[model samples]
Target: MITENTIAAISTPLGRGGIAVIRVSGKDAIAIAERVFRSSHGGEVRKFPSHTVHHGLVVAPNSQEPLDEVMLTVFRAPNSYTGEDVVEISCHGGVFVSQKVLEAVLEAGARLADPGEFTKRAFLNGKIDLVQAEAVADLIQASTERSHQEAFQQLRGGLSDQINAVRNSLVDMLALMELELDFSQEDVEFLDRQEIEERLRRSIEELDKLIASYQRGRFLREGAKITIVGRPNVGKSSLLNALLGMERAIVDETPGTTRDAIETQLDIKGVLFRVIDTAGLRQAKNRIEKKGIAITEFHIEDADVVLFLLDASEGVTRADEKIWQQVERLSQKRREMFPAKIIIVGNKIDLGNQLTKGSFDPEMGKWPLVLVSAKTLTGIPQLNETIFKAVFDERWERGDAVITNVRHLQALQKARQHLGFALETLKQGLSTEFAVVDIKGALEQLGAIVGQTTPEEVLDRIFEQFCIGK
Candidate 1:
């Protein structure tokens, strides 16, 4: 698994900072580094001990010319990130200085590293599996705290351990079924039928749990889309402003002041929510208004949650009923395609407790009824709690393994399908050979997730998403 050529790149972001690192890896890394680096102690980089840092000056190989003063750290073979002979040069941060150091390394004999080549090499060298390798990218691109925590857990082999546990059970069951297949002609049964069924059931249950976590995992990874909709002048904009703790949307006394969707992001309890304040639902007076209303409806269709605001002071009116009817029709139409949670929010409660126990009573428990005064910022915390509870489970902990990557989710789904097929075949008293086929299929799918049997093209595509020198 050793790579032939040495690779080098600026590991840090290219900008003006206190320092920037240039990483060199592969069999010839130390040799290439030694060619250009002259230690302050007058020793070659090759003689440096593993995990030791040395003060050095990078010089040109052809002519003795100092390029930059740097701190060179050496990591010997099988001990570095790429599991190769690695040298990391920490140089003064500057666009030109970092480039000069990288150029010196390349001139000394190392090739320019491709995007994600470092992580790809780690995967190829058996230092990490595909799940952990993908987690490297996830950790880097994580925007929110929850995403960061999930990525860190995945990188620490949390998701991989869970997948491998199920995979092991599947493998054991497959072995037993194969053993029984060898004695198909005899009446003797090597494995109990009920035992095989139970094993398959457990494996399927594990897969199902992982699959179920994807929805919340995805919301954590990529923020949830929340659309706020109501009739004109119902304080929709005020609620958006209150939720974000800023005046993002314009509040006006005139109805239909906001004829377009205004979007912003808010993080609630480590989970990111992309909130959209749409134009009020009403009879459009102009062509522009009509287009804006259409966009609002479109956002509703695509929203993960809808905050249907009502004026508590005025109570539910005929216009509000008409809007509810439209919402119901849309929900029915998009029940399969767009399954969004609708929370009825009673706004302007600070004006007075004018709301009566009518069609939209808080006691009915039909939909989540949250009372809030966007003007005074009253009951906002409760609204936030309701929103958080709508999407995530109360029992889920931060360290729990969540399937955030779409690739992992797809692999789990394929494995679940095969496991279901295997279970069905076993229950029907089919030939052991038939069940063995599905079991093998399930095993292969699971193996792909952890890089035991992944295709080269799939690996290439996954690593390609990563930046260079990762």
Candidate 2:
């Protein structure tokens, strides 16, 4: 194994707490920790058994003064996180205590670890692959249970095993085909043309499915945008406040209380949404309200899912009809630009004898409608559940592999496209040399997913996102 210099860092978050951990890893990790550490037994710490903890005091090398009392744990090489000698010191949790201990370790001959160096060493030493390494960061940053579950699964080699299996199959087939090309003089059939074509088609279909999952995965990682649009005094602010479960917007018994677009995050079924309560849509008399209206329109145009709030108590007035027309025109334009999906929300359902069922129609079939009272929260749960089902849950199979990273998904898609070209080449009876080139190209793309043939800069950029302790 390649040996590296010792690295040290404060592994815990910076704050005042009961305890903090300092991590050290490399060839000299234990030795470095031994120099500044004195066991309560007053014996040589290097003689201590591996994977055991001992009480000790960190002392200054020069003055022999106690820096801080600590509990030290040691792990020997080939069994630790980085496949190297490792040591962890649990000291009193304080800014000064951590800094003093770190300084003493540095004085005793250990350099501070860079961001993500520990995980980088894990990857370089074969403890994990690139996908698993990336998942460590994702798991740390995951905001919901579902995202945490996905990240943890990926970290345990779920994604790596899937990609590597496909790559191994392609490599085996390519090697057989190449061997046949080398022995053109004899009639040795290494790969049957029809059978190889069938295998390629099947692999391409599987890759397409994985690639398509990225759409839902991206939204799961990054919150979806849900813009609330309606005329003045339609309880838009009230709805926003209710969804957030906090008083993030000003809600009063007056028109246009919310004169600006207020945004907050909401979690539904472990999926996040960037909910924006825009100023109620209406003709404005003042400069500030006009600017707010302009901003609201802008948000509506850019939303991933627009929640067009209609005043159910008003029974769809002429102004409400105008708003629906505007939404319809925007929807049609959006459909042409991209696949735009929206939800229609009817508010103030608690008020009796208003907005009878099927009273107004936007004429666009399948426009989902929900009755809600943002004040009483009578239908908020139903509305929240419906929105989650419509936008977030694409019903991906439980055990089916899905590529969540955009970079990996793009590479897989390009690989699938090359597989298509390879299929066409084989059907045309092109030279075996030309066919091999396309197959190799596809193989390279597959390799990029697991870092088999990825660039050094790509590796650096990926690992840099991780925290030093990880």
Candidate 3:
């Protein structure tokens, strides 16, 4: 338990409301509150029972001048967040009032809490592990219902339990191997080589599954970046405005009107997509247009999905053919990295023409194509539905155990690599001692994901992402 000093902060967000909570924790939390709090119900705050609330008046410690009518609640050490004596002062929700009460608490001998200090104390004092500590921030910043559900599950120890289960098995195997070394002279075999190999292989498969799931997890957490690219005056901006259901981008019939990328976020069926409408992919005479094309290229390369727009009325021109060839060549280079999905969209369908059957050759793989007229607001809903289906397949599960944290993903990847080394070593008929080293290293990497073997710096960085007063 952390019992050395008290930490305090205004817990509620800045702005006016019915009330705001100022939280304090540490060994001296109660004492610090009592020094500046005066009771309205004629009971001493310092003498109040733990986990109970009392109406009170906040006053200056030296003069006893009442500042605000308040309610003070107390939690004894080892039972509260941070495992220390904690106090929550309920004051008027006015911004100035909350700030004044917090300042008073600090004046009465409590230090200001840093960003995520309360949660950090909880982690340091063993209330929660590092994975749960990170979940606190994730839970707050979650933008979608699916994200919130996933983060809450992780906060409840879903990931930790899975990691610890694997680590415990590896530790047992290592202990048995070490025991064999101790009794080698006496010819006692504490562990069977074939059985150990089987167990390790199972762990490796499980870890591999987790690492593979990160592709979906990362997209869910960060949202998909979708860039719309096409030649000049192909209604790229109109398509963007149509998708967002707003006039977020300027549109004109003249070519080269869009000279920069316009980005907007949309929640399509609870999945966030950062859609960027870039300058049309065309040869530029103006310096500004050339720069915009460069930026468009940059967004295309970094996008998680590309909406390649084609002018259905004009047909595929030489420039359009060139862009399509470039996309085809680029897809080959990214085959190993799980590259973004591309959709071939034919826009301006309302230009007094009907798109016939077999508009584009399907022989060159199933390039998803959708015909839409941005001017008439036609086919937008279907376009969005297509986007969702293309991104999240039927196998995608929400609230399933997924690793969203990058550090955890990297650690899992390293652990998988180590497990591969162990398997290779065993296959080469190497000594059990060498194989054990690789096995133990893999276990340690997995342990770090759950805070069992994490470094101090990693903990510091994770907690630092939390907002102050969290």
Candidate 4:
């Protein structure tokens, strides 16, 4: 579909830089750009070949006064990002120059592009699908190499291909079911019950796999939360600094230096981890101390991996045992809801004559333990590896389609539920018409993932997360 009005935006981030890019798209993009941009060689911008770049100067429309020297790139209709005539002006990086250039384009008849309008136009014009459109935003916001790779794969249509494959299977089954419905009076069985059940089972299995990937996918997209919990002066803050390669938390000989939770992000082997250093766990000497300890416990509960540090030089004290008891109680209560893994870290091994490997109770139930010296950075690499493995123990291979978006996951879950209902109906020997209802419901849910039947409000919400220039 061709957009009627031209739109313009500063594609590059707003600020002073070597160069800033202003993008214009739609039917009148070329005409609008030609009116405000004067070529260095006195050539017309409209006559430039598609995908060609020319030296130019942006000038005010009425005054014809030079605003800034620029490099103009032309992309003609059916070949541009939005499948429309598009022009990009590379101007001097000054904020005023770029704004004035954008103003010139606006004054020449191009409207300001809204948040994600360029990408939205791509979707509407069939240049990309809904999933790929969202991937554009994901690619922009990706923080780690792993997330960037995932977003790149999605933008290249990996996830969309998987969803389309499953949807095609459902469409085929729906066709056969509809055929059965058309001949209901003839008592003709278009497809055997066994075959129908088998197809439904396979579809459900595919949906189930996508649904199961949400946890790891979410962790990959938004870094896993790792919280450090231990008694005072157990090197919790030191560990945080060592992992981040910077002093993110205050380190001192004094106990309870960290009176609140200090959170920072770290990238390990392409995966992002949010490391949180919390106040030491101990009996409250006063109301403020009690609040800090309470906050520490709360972080422990919500963490993806709880690093329970023990001072190797001091050995496990009675106070340490009490804290372990508290951790155990909380773990037992929320075992099903919050499945955060507990890793026992023995710190300060550089002090020498530290606790032996078997010093802790074997009853701790096989929690992974690593000995480290935070001051000397000894065994720190092993500690990092242990932390990553504790959270992502599943066998995941690259290039596999994973569901990182919560909306997609929810849709897959609903699709699985509907498939389950259809299977149950088939097993109960119900009418084919009854089974058709559940199958169609599953199809609709899957369609929503690709924006085939999604509500307009959902699209707005999803694109609103993107920056205005996207």
Best model per TM-score: 4
The positional error of residue 398 in candidate 4, measured at the CA in angstroms, is: 1.0
Whole-model Cα lDDT of every candidate shown, in order? 0.88, 0.82, 0.84, 0.88
1 versus 3: better lDDT goes to = 1
lDDT top scorer:
1
Worst lDDT run of 10 residues, candidate 2, spans: 331-340
Clashes of each: 0, 0, 0, 0
RMSD of candidate 4 to the truth, in angstroms, is 1.9
Runs in model 2 with CA error above 4 Å? 1-3, 283-287, 321-340, 352-363
User: lDDT tens digits, residues 242-289, model 1?
Assistant: 999999999999999998999999999888999999999999989999
lDDT for model 1, please.
0.88
Q: Residue 396 CA error for candidate 4 (Å)?
A: 0.3
Write one digit per residue (lDDT tens) for candidate 3, span 215-285. 66776677878889888899999998898888999888899888889888988888788999989877788
Q: List the residue pairs that clash in candidate 2.
A: none
Model 1 spans with C-alpha error above 4 angstroms = 329-338, 361-365
Please estimate how well model 2 matches the true structure, expressed as its whole-model Cα lDDT. Answer: 0.82
Each candidate structure's TM-score, on Cα atoms with residue i matched to residue i, is 0.95, 0.92, 0.95, 0.95
lDDT of 2 by residue, 119-210 (tens): 88888888888888888888888898777777888888888887887788888888988999898789788888998898888878878777
